[model samples]
Target: MTNKLTVKIWRGKEQGDFVSYEVPRLASQTVLDVVTYVQRNLEPSLGYRFACRVGMCGSCAMTVNGVARWTCRTHVSKVVGEGQLEIAPLANLPVVKDLVTDMSEFFDKWARAKGSFKGKRTRADDFEPVKPDSRERKAADAGVECIGCGVCYASCDVVSSRPDYLGPAALNRAWTLVNDVRDTQQRERLRAVAGDAGCHACHTQGSCTVHCPKQISPTAGIAGLKRVVGRAAVRGRL
Candidate 1:
C-alpha cells in the first residue's frame, strides 16, 4: 500500500550483485512491470526477455523474492513483502546478462533425454487412434503441456548440484513421450534416460512440482519414468 517499492535487481553476468531501485507502486502491478519500469524509465541499458505479456509464453519468469515465478502473472501485492522486492535470474542456468539466462544447456538435456517424438508411421498414414481415457493416454496428458519455461528446471535442486543431471522438464517430457503408444522409440528413449545423468539422477525433492507455474508435476512423471526405465533395464530392453 506504499507509494513506492524498493526493488533489488541483479545487474551482471555470472558474477553479479544486487542493485537497489525505487519503483512507483501501482494497484495490481506485476514484477515484470517493475523490471520494465526500471528499464524503460530509469535505466535503458537493463536487459530482460519477454515475449507474450500474458501467462501463455512463460518467458517473463524470474526469481522474485528467492522463488522462481512467471513475472507476468505475479502480482506485486502478493509477493512484495515489507514493501520490497528482490529480483534475480532463474537459478541453475547460465546467466547471459542482467535478467536473461542462457538456455543452451537446458534444451541440450532435453535432446539428451530423447524428448522428441519418433513414430513408425509416415505422414501418409492415417491418424493413429488413441484412447483418451486409457491409462497411458491419461498419464501422457498430464505432462504434455510444458512450455519449457524452465521454472521447474530452475527450482530443481538436482540441477544445481549435479550439472550433468537431466533436469525435471526434460525428464518429464521423456516420461510423456514414453507413455505415448504412437511413439516407437521407447527403447532408445528409455536408454537415453536411464543413467545417472538421466531420470535416475532425480532426488524427487519436489521443488519442480512446487514451483511449476502450469501445475504440472514433474516429480510424478519422473517417478513413472523410474518405474518404466527400471522395468526396461531389467527386461534387457534398455
Candidate 2:
C-alpha cells in the first residue's frame, strides 16, 4: 500500500473548482474509500452522496479519472496513474454540491419516457406464466437490472447537447417494458418514446454503454426502441 496518494476532487456546485487532497493510500482501496477518507479527515465540509458501499446501490457513481464509473467498485490501483486521480460529479446534469449531482432531471426523464410498467393483471386473476426462453422475456431480461445510477445519462453526449432528451437510461427502461409480455402499455410507451426528445434523439455514440457499471447496454436498448417505434409509426400506430 502506498502511504500517500494525491486526489484531485471537484469541490463546488455548478461553478467551482477541483481541489486537490493528499490521502494515505491503503491496500485494495476503492475510489469511494479515498473520497471517504478525505471527507472524514481532511475536509468535513466536502459533499458527496452514497448509501450502500456495495455496487448494488449505484449511488456512488462519479467521474473518476476522466471516466464515469461507480466509485464504490472502482479500485484506485486500477484507475489511478502517476500517483494522481481526478474525481468529479457525474456530467450532463446540474451539480448540487461538490461531488453530488442533482438526479431529479435524470429520474424525471424516466417519467417522460414512460418507463413505468402498466400491469394488466389483477390480484384475482391467475398467475401469468412467462417463459424465460421467450424472446420478449429474454429481451426484457437483458436490461432489467439497472440501478438508476445515472452513469449512462452522464456519459451520453446527446444529453449534454440536448437538455430535453429523455436519455439512454430512461429510453432503456422503456425498452425493457416494451418487451415485457405482461406490460399492457406497449403502444403508449412506444408513443412516449417515439418523438424527437425520445429514442430518436440518440446518436448512438455508445458512451452510455461504455460507462454503465451494470453492464447494461442502454445504447442497444435505445436502438431497439427506435426500431419498434419506427415500425409502429409506419403502421400508423403513432
Candidate 3:
C-alpha cells in the first residue's frame, strides 16, 4: 500500500472528462472518503451526492473503475489498483454534475411499472390479517427490502441496449406487489410490466442481480413477472 493514490474523478456533466488528483492514502479509508477529500481539500467546487455515510441511505452509489458500487462501503484497499482510482457517476443515467447522476428517469420507470401498491381497503375498513408463512407473503418477503438504490438499474445491460426498457428495480417492485394479496392492482400491474419495453424485454443476463448491493435478485423477480404475464396472455387476460 502506498502513501498516496492517483485519483481520477469525473469533473463535469454528461459532456465532461476525468480530472486527476493525488490524494493521501489513509488507514481503513473508503472510496467515499477519497472523494470527500478531493472535494473538501483539493477542489471545493466539485459536486457529488451522499447521505448517511454508513451505507443505509444508498445515496452514495457511483461508478468506480467501470463498476457501479456504494462508495461509502467500498474500501480503498479493495478497489485501489497500482495506487490509482477512477470515480464517476453511475451509468445509464443522465449526469447532473460530477458524481451526481440525474435519478428522475430511474424513478420514472418505477412509476411506469406500477411499482406502488394499490389496496382496496379504505380508512374505515378493518385491518386485514395476513399470514406470514403463506406463499404470497413469502414471495412478497423475498423482494420487499428494495431501497431504490438504482445500482441494479445502472448495472443492467438491457437498459443500455433498450432505452425504453422499464429496468430491473421497477420490475422487481412490481413483482413484490404481484405477490401481495392485499394489493388490488395485480392485473393492472402485470399489464404495465408485460409488453415490449417491459418484462419480456429482459434477456435475463443477470447483471442487475450480479451488481445489486442489496443482494436483491431482480432477475428472479423479472422471471416471475414473465411467468405471470405469459399465463395471463395465454388466458387472454393481459
lDDT, candidate 2, 191-221, per-residue tens? 8998889998999999988878889998889
Off by over 4 Å in 3: none
TM-scores for all predictions: 0.98, 0.97, 0.97
What would you estimate as the lDDT of candidate 3? 0.93
Candidate structures ordered by TM-score, highest first: 1, 3, 2
Q: List the residue pairs that clash in candidate 3.
A: none
- For residue 56, give model 2's deviation from the true position in Å: 0.2
Per model, how many backbone clashes are there?
A: 0, 0, 0
Ten-residue stretch with the least lDDT total in model 2: 112-121
Q: Local error of candidate 2 at 44, Å?
A: 0.6
lDDT per residue as tens, model 1, 1-238: 5598999999999998999999999998999999999999998988899989899988888999999999999999999899899999999999999999999999999999998999888999999999999999999999999999999999988888899999999999999999899998888888888887988888888999999999999999999999998887788886
Alpha-carbon runs more than 4 Å astray in model 2: none
Per lDDT, the best of the predicted structures is: 1
